[model samples]
Target chain A: MRGVSLATPYLHIDLPQLRINVRRAADQAALVGVALRPHAKTHKSAEVARLQLAHGAVGLTVATVGEAEHFVRQGCRDVFIAFPVWVDEGRATRLRDLRDQADRLAIGVDSVESAGNAGRRLGHTGIEVLVEVDSGHHRTGVAPEQAGVVARAAQRAGLPVRGVFTFPGHGYGPGGSEAAAHDERTALETARDSIQQVGIEEPVLSGGSTPTLAASLTSRAATELRPGVYVFGDAQQWELGIFEPDDISLTVHATVVSHAGGRVVLDAGSKTLGADRAAYSSGYGRLLEHPEARIVTLSEHHAVVQMPGPRPALGSLVSVVPNHVCSAVNLADTFWVAEPGGLRAWPVGARGLHT
Target chain B: MRGVSLATPYLHIDLPQLRINVRRAADQAALVGVALRPHAKTHKSAEVARLQLAHGAVGLTVATVGEAEHFVRQGCRDVFIAFPVWVDEGRATRLRDLRDQADRLAIGVDSVESAGNAGRRLGHTGIEVLVEVDSGHHRTGVAPEQAGVVARAAQRAGLPVRGVFTFPGHGYGPGGSEAAAHDERTALETARDSIQQVGIEEPVLSGGSTPTLAASLTSRAATELRPGVYVFGDAQQWELGIFEPDDISLTVHATVVSHAGGRVVLDAGSKTLGADRAAYSSGYGRLLEHPEARIVTLSEHHAVVQMPGPRPALGSLVSVVPNHVCSAVNLADTFWVAEPGGLRAWPVGARGLHT
Candidate 1:
């Protein structure tokens, strides 16, 4: 690997800035009296997970059993599969094996059928099950009122039911965080009550999203918070005023290949920076050197940047903050860590582990 | 490693269809009396490159010097870097070394300054250069009128100026094949004249895209065709009527993770299927099992498929045709080749060779 200046279209992660972001999230969670389970899906590196754990993260939240297995192998004692995964025979066997490896293993089940499937596949395996409740996202999870029915199905299969969880994904919109947090609180409370009706008391209510993490501090009903993107502030978070540009720890360094016709073309494109256009996003990515410049279009390996004034010189390096850092991280195999000495390369451990 | 029935969100490549597609392109190029240089960026696999060469391809086209190096190491003799790359000192040295490895090596130079830079850095390296001409696709390349200027710069720098090339990318649009082919032919003719003015007579003229390949048969001035996506038909090509459903050799095998409401969530998402939505495309991908089903929304790991009829049962496998095959192939590390007897794994030789 070359230095950050020469490795154009490479993901440059600022270690100092990453430490600050991790500490800030951990401190906030401590002040709110809620256990912080920073999502591992954001960085997907054991090195970063160690930093989060060092900063007082109770555990790590993952998205798949494959990610859980990867982290468990890396000595992550506790892991929660935050997604409502459908467990077939193969995945069930894997999850059973993962439970033996991890000190604490929890999974989300959004429906009664899913709960039954999991319970039948991993009954009495010391795997904690969390029923997912729809807190206005409506993508996954069951209704808050239906939590008892799902918990009953898990109990019938001789499994342990821990609590309820919800993701306020709708908070990722213009002026929607406050309302989304409110919905999260209401849904978790209702789900906790329904879980009690199924004879499970003091249920662990979990809810959080990057946009609603601050609002979640006021939610007394929530006992745990899971926010992934806060650790690596992206272009979306910066534009939403949730974090400053300086807080963005990761950026894709691109070289200006063409500088003509009031436009600059960078070597970075969808394959490097990813193709995630948020509803409020102005462009595909934000250039750190020229904040006014917008990446208007992205082909497989070419990003067309519309310059505000004069374009940068050809072959010069320009840092770009991706719209979604998670997608960008997922695309890259290695990240060049920015340090005082120079740069270091770290492999993205859980990349391409979608299964 | 497993069968398609168990490997969710896996790239299933039909060997029979791929062989047919490879033979067809080679035969068409032979009939037109033009050398076929299949773009390896589509599959990024040495296995696919072998298939192309076995069917009479003259060389392989790639988007980066890294890809060219990978193919050379995999025993590909003739390789062309078809992108106007910005080469720093480190890359210039690598190019020099690569020139010694490949029997024939050429790099794209679109600007007079790039030509000058390449000439100064790689002078007397025996590396052939091709001037890129804009054929109505304004993404990159110099105007046809400016080709002589770039060629002269390269010639002055002691670099071998062998040809001019254009990618009719605008032909990807709806009903744009005929017009794009016309523009491609006109641009190449003009660029050839400009090259002749630079005292390089009989310079090779190259142009091709999957949409305009048929119409390109009428371009007598063109001596070479470089089409990438013809090897793997995608949803965009099917929508354009360029390929039938049966011609789609590559598909993402996704399992139904969630069956709820009017939608079925597939294990395949943007991370698996890729986030490439063409302007004329309808959905993220097309389901082969349910032709009417559309992949409406894609998170990092969950694809929400809106079904027109009854949803597929949970855990059942469904094949999805990605909107862009190149993007999908780039995202995958391995392709599961579906043979008549069983499945075999092939590493994507240059999956992340974006230099």
Candidate 2:
């Protein structure tokens, strides 16, 4: 909303609120005696990662080797590729380079063949491999009972098996975060048992998503938490009752372009706001100025807002909180950071780095 | 399907197929005696635009001012910004520059206020404005009868009202394209009569979408067709029975990362293969190799495929057709164009230019 002087449909961050979130997450993780490696995919800025590190975040968690390489170049010492990435010759070379650049680097592996493929190229590089366990979401990852088999396969491939991890994506829905957190701990504990039975000692049980972070810090079962969206509260977190509107640090600055047929059309649409409307999400996003407004339809560059009351006038600026902040951030090349003094642009580094 | 040597999660275009689709579209437009101004937002590649022009496309249609500037810089002389853009001081300056560079520049205006704003800034620059009429899709544009009122408003603001345009976006569903095309013609014809009532003779009746392209070729209604996704057939078009599987020219080169729970996981997920799923879309996307596979789930870097038969082995390559080609192309920086001899990289020149 403060980006009035700037153009419409630009991403901006409230630095003070971002810092508040960073400190809050680190303090909460420390209170429960669990390590915090915040996912860098949400902000995708080296500056934001620096703030997380300054607040006692252990390292960074990324989904792609390109993201890891980016942060490593930005001087991040420890990095983890949380997704079960398939390693081919090209990706192996990139991972090897990242391994050489960073102090500690790890990747997730869920299958024996992928473990073998990665171990053959990255085993000598001291890259630790974590077995991914399916908590409940069932998108990826091995079953809790199969963790031991994957760990043994990694060991046979001459790669070090670090621990087991699970993403409780189920927490993002209508089900309460407590239930998903319980399921996360259950799966991680079972996977730990399976890994220990396979002769792996003291496995690090990693689990956490933004929706489950508050309920995920069980010191007895979990060693680390990887919550991405807490730093920048999105529409999903607010609608799920996990965060307040004031906790949202990032927003898209859009303008009222059309006020026709008793509806308001904003300049921001799916391309600008990112086309990520979760089933549980209230709308495409939340209009900060008009909380009662619902974005019923989104074209490529037009957000048709259905307001409960009077809509804003044309040419006026408003802030929009995207449903999925990570996907939204990926659509922009750069974002403005609002400091105590003024705003400055920062590149969305590692954007379009899907590989 | 020929990006075998490249990495997974990269976009590749079959040049021969692209050329065939381009020629077919041009030929159809010619047979109907209508103008073809293919939307460049689908591919966003200068090479693709050049191919369309070579095949007799009148010009290019873009969605944003930044997209228009990108094409203008790439030597696309006649470009139309199809979205009803809100003109602020910053966008006005950019539009002014684009109007200066391009041979013919036009923008869509659905509201009288936005038309006045654009006309005040760009009137002297020789930019044309097209009044958008609601032709079934209630997203943007004015009602058919209100077209005259907005046309008179634009004329009063010192801007040339070039024509009336409508997007038959409703055609992109299972209701079938023929009915939507009928609605498009009816709306455009009514809008034409309204503009004529305002004393604007022979107003250009511009309308089209990929879903309605086949039925859109009526000499009595539309003057120009702006079908974007026809060049690179998407899963939505294929599911709606508008395009066949072989008509698809672009596909995502993804690799099997895991095979768990009777599902195969690919490295290309929502981040790589866009997150656009129409209600009528079959699934998240269609696999080129395994047409029976349905993309059940998508993580940041994982596309969980539920196949009826045996899944592809881990580390094997597969091609994926995204649900929306434009959104998918917006996610990649560059794509490999498979030629008769070899492949060449073409930058998605207008990537991330979502003003």
Best by DockQ: 2
TM-score of chain B of 1: 0.97
- Show the colliding residue pairs in model 1: A9-A253
Scored by lDDT, model 2 comes in at 0.87
* Model 1 Cα lDDT, one tens digit per residue, A140-249: 78889989999999988767888999998889887889999999999999999899998998888989989899999877668999899998899988888787898889
Clashing pairs in 2: none
Q: How many backbone clashes does candidate 2 have?
A: 0
Model 2 alpha-carbon miss at residue A149, Å: 2.0
lDDT of 2 by residue, A151-199 (tens): 9989888788889999999988876688889999899999999999989
For residues B256-337, what per-residue lDDT tens digits would candidate 2 score against the true structure?
8888766788899888888888887778999988888899887778888888866688888899999988889989999998
B115-220 per-residue lDDT for model 1 (tens digits):
9889999878899899999898777789998899999999999889988999998998889998999999999999999999989988989899888888897675
lDDT of each: 0.87, 0.87
